[model samples]
Target: MVRTQDLTYSYDARHILQFPDMHCAAGEHWLLLGQSGSGKTTLLHLLGGLLSPHGGFVEVASTRLNNLSASELDHFRGQHIGIIFQQPHFVQSLTVEENLLLAHQLAGFRPERRRAHELLAHLHIGHKSNVRPNRLSQGEQQRLAIARAIINRPKLVLADEPTSALDDHNCEEVLALLEREAGQVGATLLIVTHDGRLKDRFHHRIFLQSTQA
Candidate 1:
């Protein structure tokens, strides 16, 4: 569902990421393991269509991202890509339901209140529907972020340092939540983290430094 050929990136005239090829199939859960500043997060940004490549092609859902205009890219990203950042950025003034509703509406998709609630319920945090993000714990906020990402039922989900801030128990919970939820929606999972602890859970591993990272 996602493929890249000759992908390379740099910053301030210094090479940061350089991968010639990588492919993520539909329904596959990939764990991107690497150390900080090793280009894992940079790669995730490219995968999510958040940053344009310095060189080479990036294709997500079979669409060549390099060929898309700014508006087109934004539209395509909102409709096809789901991103869960290390920090959950929600509208503090909006309730949990409204935050998700905004994602749908901005993408030109109809907001389904019931579906939003169902997603929260699926995460076992449905009780926070009426609660704003300020009242939730860090773990609860992360769960809410996951719900928002999949609310559009995106075909690809990209997570950046998802388990970085959590304790061991919360880390496992977040990982399980990501796996089960991605599977339920038939979305491809591409997670980027330096934590080697996640390696055993996934078989298709992409080590950035091992091969042109």
Candidate 2:
């Protein structure tokens, strides 16, 4: 679950972004629609505890992010928030499976090799378990990113412009995977995107106006 109130962020004295209030229930899916410079990504980072807000607060699963120390926020985010960045990033040296295991380790949870394998299989990439990430195709890499994000069974899943680069078929495929996987984990899914292709897919949405002032 997520709740935000009077959220405001500033890059400097001259530019400040104000975000609308949001209340999303657990296990629900919502879309955050906004144009470029509207602060969609900035809001996502605040919600994920990746960026500290200059004003107001972000609460996720009942924990207020503004109250957490840096280390605490990092640990909390690792355990509770799963973020799928627009671009998938991986440790090129690690195999697909190893990358997943590393997520568990970083979260302070014991590595679950079986869970990792099962998740990859569920994502239809079990065969690539031992393969390095760079060798995978774009679609495969995307699936790997999805797999990595939810492997910890996080309570909240935040995706940024997930379908921006995909063709229609691939875009739908990726969205389906994100929804199904997040559903399986009982996570509240919030996707931040400017893509019109996604508008009709989600009934619950938050539209942000450009806060350029």
* Runs in model 2 lying further than 4 Å from the true structure: none
- For model 1, residues 1-213, the per-residue Cα lDDT tens digits are 999998888876644568748988999999888777778888899988889998899998899999999999999999988999998889999998899899888888999988998998988888888888888999999999999888898999999999989999989999999999999999999999987678899998888773342
Candidate 1 wrongly placed segments (more than 4 Å)? 210-213
lDDT of each: 0.89, 0.94
Clashes of each: 0, 0
What is the Å distance of residue 167 in model 2 from its true position? 1.0
* Clashing residue pairs, backbone N/CA/C < 3 A, model 2: none
TM-score of candidate 1 relative to the true fold: 0.96
TM-score of each: 0.96, 0.98
lDDT of 2 by residue, 68-171 (tens): 99999999999999999998889988999999999999999999999999999998999999999998888888999999899999999999998898889989
TM-score of 2: 0.98
Q: Which window of 10 residues has the lowest lDDT sum in candidate 2?
A: 204-213
